[model samples]
Target: MKEGIHPNYREVCFVDLSNGFKFVTRSCANTKEMIEMEDGRKLPLFKLDTSSESHPFYTGTQKSVDTMGGRVEKFRNRFARSVK
Candidate 1:
């Protein structure tokens, strides 16, 4: 609860560069850009290369290694002969 020792925490607009998605949230991240919202409020703009909206893992576009069915099967076949 100290004064004049904490970074300025305020509402900032985050934009996903890949998908052009914009959202606002409170953060202490330093930014040099500004964006105007639909409500006509100008806020600090923070650009992101990847966000939950466009990330492969969050959008279910990432392929799993086990589902590929080749690398794991090859490893198992190689080890199966050694075990026998």
Candidate 2:
């Protein structure tokens, strides 16, 4: 709220690498590169490694972990046989 003490909040564009999706929003984060939007507006292009669009929680494309495999599963099976 002070003079020149607040960060500049401006409209920026975020691009998801995996999905190649683009979205416009306001942000105070800095970026080294930018791109022009369809509205003839210069938007700071921010490259994010992950976003909700491509994330497993939002997209519902999650992979399950198989614990019953490999050396651990074999050891467990052997141990159970020994116990019995």
The best candidate in terms of TM-score:
1
Query: Which 10 consecutive positions of candidate 1 have the poorest summed lDDT?
Result: 64-73
Candidate 1 residue-wise lDDT, 1-84, digit = tens? 989999889999999999999999999999999998999999999999999999999999998767646887889977997885
For residues 32-55, could you state the per-residue lDDT of candidate 2 as single tens digits?
898988889988899988899989
Model 2: colliding residue pairs:
none
Q: Give the poorly placed runs of model 1, Cα more than 4 Å off.
A: 68-84
The count of backbone overlaps in candidate 1 is 0
Candidate 1: residue 15 lDDT (0-100): 97
* TM-score of each candidate structure, all chains considered together: 0.76, 0.71
The local distance difference test score of model 1 is: 0.93
Q: Which pairs clash in the backbone of model 1?
A: none
